[model samples]
Target: MTANKIELRSVNVTRYITPLREGGSLPALAEADDDFKYVLKFKGAGHGVKALIAELLGGEIARTLGLKVPELVFARLDEAFGRSEGDEEIQDLLKGSQGLNLALHFLSGALTFDPVVTQVDPTLASKIVWLDAYTTNIDRTVKNTNMLIWHKELWLIDHGATFYFHHAWDNWEKAAMSPFPYVKDHVLLPQAALVEEINDEMIALLPDEKLREITNLIPAEWLSWEGTNTNADAIREVYFQFLVQRRNNANNFVKQIQHARETLV
Candidate 1:
């Protein structure tokens, strides 16, 4: 995860436009004080701030791998911004999310990626597959690719579903090297014949310090979950250790993918 860092911007939500209903978390289209539109996902969503943490890390990982990811920002929610909304549920979400939440710069007119209509390059496909495998992202199935096509380029999005195993931290380390069965259903698996190459590159690029910096980018308040007793800094160290171990033992995950590829064939 070594790349020119995009300084995370913080902007206050100036207006609530509309809800993007397709997203289960009720992410909304909103205009920010910075004069940019962003699809803001609330910190108070049912999935909790862990999802936002995953989004930040996953998007940064994709960017380091030379994949296109929209600029990520912390969308500052004013407690009163959504008070006037007609939908009480959405209003509740907004009010609960006051302070800071995760958001991505909105790409106007970008179309959802349709696997049936688009054929990605095998190498690029391999890199995407490798990324999802490493992060344990569960959202990039054929039913929901979580990608977009803008300006004739593939853009990765909606990585909030990543690092799912973090939800059950009791056995997080034991599960670090565990097989990723979901890779079989990955929409791009059939085209990801060169994943090992990507894996090698990512392993070399994602040094401990680089990954530490990525985790540091996460807001401390976001890391302090309800059920966790550890402070934010300790939790961040946990993420770093998990990532470093996974980086070292990525071969186990890569092997799982290769075996599944054989079955798919």
Candidate 2:
């Protein structure tokens, strides 16, 4: 599980295109210095930098497992950004989000994944279900698949909801090893027949060494928030520990997913 250093690209936000109002976090599609459009997640909105941390961790972890995820980048917002915005809400959000933010490369012409029309292979479906269970991601329900079909391939997105335990850090250890009951509502649960079979293989992909590498990618500023007295490295260590504990206890959730799928199908 030894990993090479992760090299996430950084981009400067050049222009704000438009806000994707569908998301509570108010993510925006904007042009970057590279002239490519990206879906920008502001650090000042919703759960603040913690959400970005979850996105970074979740997306990168998925990519490491050989899943399709849009290229993640660190988007820099200058002090003068959003100076001419007419919307007061967006202007304030921009002002608060100045400095570093997180973004995903925009997959142009991608279509929302519809479970009815598109069928995922049992193995891929099982892997996705396993990933959601491992990360404790609760956002990929039927109501919002949080997946898209780009170039006829399933691509995952919107991982800001993962690692909810950190939002209330006191019970993090308890949450880490807990079985994710929410897997019952997963959109891909019906097709995830190999949940148990893939448990060892999937867990093998995320050893403690790789987990440390993923947590190390979180920016220092994103770790310190309004109410936390903990230092950035300490917070990162907590994240690494949580992930390692979760992986060690993967069977707890693998069984849960199998039972849920059995009940569903």
Candidate 3:
């Protein structure tokens, strides 16, 4: 982490405007004391705090690599706001997430990235695919491409679907070394002709220090899992190690993606 690395700002949610109900977790649009509209994902959602952690770490890593990801911040949720909510589910979510939660600075008029309407650059597609492959993200499929396009450019979002291997912590090492065969179905893979080149580029860009720097940015509360009695630091270490090991063993996924691209008709 450099002295000038982006700081994750902390702000209080001033109003819960509306819920984005399309997703299972029910993230909401809220106004922060900073007076910015944000898409806030609650820590207490059914997906749990780990989802928020993934959102921050994954999205931040993309930004560091010059990928377009909206600014993320920590939103402090006050439980008092939950009392006036009519939805039982959202009320429980607000009350449970009464402290820090993950938020993305809302892009007022951004359109969801539509492949039919946009032709992406092969280099950018390959880089985005490399990002997903390295992170084990299965959510970027054609059907549910979790991306947005603002100002005629692509923006990555919704990384809760990445890092699913963490759910089985015991075999995480093996999982980290596992090949990401699903890259074949990535929405951008057809244009990802430069995936191998992108892999080499990212390998040069992400050092162990940089990877650990991103992992350490995750908030402590989000690292603690009461459901699993998981320790915050231990989980953090697991994430750090998984990323470092993933990069060190990049050949596994690099080969998988290249092979997948070769087979694509």
TM-score of each: 0.96, 0.98, 0.96
Off by over 4 Å in 3: 1-3, 227-230
List ranges where model 1 is wrong by over 4 Å: none
Of 2 and 3, the candidate ahead on lDDT is 2
Locate the minimum summed-lDDT window of 10 residues in model 2: 1-10
Angstrom error at residue 100, model 3: 1.0
Q: Best candidate per TM-score, number?
A: 2
Query: Which parts of model 2 are misplaced by more than 4 Å?
Result: 1-4
Residue 261, model 3: lDDT of 86
By TM-score, the better pick of 1 and 3 is 1
Model 3, global lDDT = 0.87
Q: Which rank order by lDDT, best down to worst?
A: 2, 1, 3
Instruction: Report the alpha-carbon TM-score of model 3 versus the true structure.
Output: 0.96
Q: Is candidate 1 or candidate 2 better by TM-score?
A: 2
Q: After superposition, how far is residue 32 of candidate 1 from its true place, in Å?
A: 0.5
Task: Write candidate 2's Cα lDDT for 1-265 as tens digits.
Answer: 3656678999999999999997689999999999999999999898899899999999999998889999999999999999999999999999999999999999999999999999999999999999999999999999999999999999999999999998888879999988999999999999998888888888888877889999999999887766779899999999999999999999999989988877873
Deviation in angstroms for 122 in model 2?
0.4
lDDT score, candidate 2: 0.93
